[model samples]
Target: MMSPIASLTLSISDNATPYYLQLREQILAAIREKRVSPEDKLPSSRSLANMLGVSRSVVTQTYDQLVAEGVLVSKPKRGIFIANTSLITMPLESLPEAKSAEPEKTVGYFDSSADHSVFPHKAWAASMRRAWLNPDPKILMGNYRLGFPQLKEQLAKFLYSLRGLECGAEQIIITAGNRDALQLLQHMLKKHVNQWYTENPTYPPINASLTGQLEHLDVQLGGALPPENTSPWAAVITPCRQYPLGISYSSQCREKWLQTLSEKQGFVIEDDYDNEFIFHGRPVTTLFQAAKHRVSAEERVFYVGSFSKTLFRGLRLSYVVVPKAFVKPVLESQKQLGQSASLPMQPALSDFMASGAFYRHLNKMRRHYRMKRDYLESLLNAHLSQWFEWEKPTAGMHILLRLKTPYADDPEISGFLKSYAMTQGLQLSLLEDHYVDPMLATKGIVLGFSNTSENDMECWVNVISQCLGCYFDG
Candidate 1:
């Protein structure tokens, strides 16, 4: 058999990259693909240079760099060889097929995400650069078990200004996102709480994240209050605006829920996600704010908020305002599990918030999304009224269009519509998919308007009309 080095199809292409780098990549690829194993002998710089018709200096540079990176071993007096390092092995058979050159057709996706076109890239870049140039010693040392202190301080200020929530930096824990916050709460509270409860038509990921027996509270029949039991329980609630349904909990509902939690010694995970996007009216009082004055309120409530919906989702930054008593345990659990939210972006986000860029971005998105929401409502009224009826949402990014006529096969119909919509370059979400129990799900479609453009909205609305005609007329 040919030597492993000789078998590698190394070539110096006429590209921007240097010849030495090109040869280095080809050799690395061979090792990664397992064509060359650890401890395999490599040809000397002179021999490789002669074989490839390149200068000895180029080969020597490549070898020296690889040896420094521990990819190659320079054994004194012996020939150079591949180092016995833990290089990843990607077998040739398992390699993915090369992507086609043709660009994919753009699809009008109605998912709950911020408009990517409006992201404040310049402002964010400035904040990132500032943070990098004047790095905080706490962030650089990675000493923040709870979170970057400056970010926690800024978040506390922002939350107090936005929602009248009284909290301190010590009570806040930076998480990857809402799901990460929920998972951390589950870990910390699993022993004390007997059962977990969520709204019936809740965010599906909430149900997926919690372990142990989970029960659903009905939102329609004024069953927002959990059942009173001797055993202490925990609940995950979206109080500012219910997901999919877009209904805010009334003052009476909030009071009743808090009373039940207090009497039963239960805990609540208040998910105040996307409340900043409220369009028409004044912002509603948060569950955390409502429970703050209650006896032992600090121990009974955990407030969760995230930037994924308000800002771009890729930020992957969320925070949980935990009870004062549980802060140390949660931080300890985070230490054991490893930090979920990355450290580099935390300081940058702190700068963004402190400099008032975050508030400005929120104000801009609120206006932009409100206009999109109204435009979509008008299109649905003009075109899809006969088959569907929807109440215009005052908060959150999406609207739920309930079917005019209840069908027993609603799930199947919605699933079929989702598949059909994808073929026509329009993405749709099934309202039924949001329910914990499929049997309790309402027949509807949830359309996200925040990310959809006016032109795409009109185009997709007509396509949706055509889709409905196929379903109803046939």
Candidate 2:
């Protein structure tokens, strides 16, 4: 029988794509179209290269890649043949049109994300370079499962200087981000606790991550601690700056929670996200700090902090400071399940903190975000004041605007606004979605100003005004 290679037709063009890739695609297409069958022999690289009028290396490269992908098989001294395995059975004609290379344009996106334009790129790059050039032996060997010790040490100091919370480096476990930290905590505590509580109108992801029977503590009711009960439970609190509302837990409220948890043998996951972005006065006292002084035994507060808000969301680095008792078990859990946070960036982050670049970046962002918040507030006040009411947030990235007119079907109105905003390339979030029970949610909209520029904010505010006007007028 004639070799299958003689029957096959392959060609390449001098287009933008590389020669080897084009050849590879042609071979893949032939295989998918059933022009080649399994176990059919093909000519050697040199023979195929001569037939195709391309270099031998190009054929070799294409064959090697197809072999790696299991689309082709090589039997020693025999020849290359199509593998029995199928390649993406879907027909090429059915595939959707390719997306454009340029990103889609948006008028505004009011998201609680760090302003990438203001990131300290030069300093971060320098830190990354230093980390790679003089990497610690432990980091290279991947010995520390809990976290890189240098990063934990710097974070320990950072907590002390910023929040007056004292913790040993051994007690901190590095995580991918807030969700990772919460999932870890949930895994660790699920065996001991039967119930979990979170603030009503909390960060939606927090509710999604925690397991077991979950309940909400009403933030409108002062977010007080649950009644003194013997059953062990865990509550996730954003004391530094509550999500959506942007209100800090008062000192008295913090004390009550710590005292209740100490007595009830419960735990509190203190999500201290965005604590560094306090626009006005010093940051509020942390629940972790209060727990440290009050509870002598295993500290009841699990303090979770992330660089996503302060640095950039793409960094995917966060840490949870557990009690002294949890250090060993948490490390064991980390070893069993594998560390989720990327190890390579840990050393660079340690260097960034040590070289004072992290702090400098924080200071710069504080001023930048504060100015943005002020600008957004002014626009809202100037254009939408007649229809909306809001208290200017002293800290954090977002502002909650309550509609002055109470609608019987508030959620419908919120849904309408959100959908209309999307039509104009402006993303808007509904306050109702934050609550566990949508019926109890307040009538408001949440706007994040950190990532939106002043001009964009003004444009978005006007768009919101038009959306509301249309809703009421119609």
Error of 2 at 222 (Å): 2.6
Off by over 4 Å in 2: 1-108, 227-229, 407-411
lDDT of 1: 0.79
Best candidate according to lDDT: 1
Q: Candidate 1 at 52: error in angstroms?
A: 39
C-alpha lDDT of candidate 2 relative to the true structure? 0.78
lDDT of each: 0.79, 0.78
Error of 2 at 86 (Å): 16
Candidate 1 worst ten-residue window by lDDT: 92-101
Q: List clashing residue pairs in candidate 2.
A: none
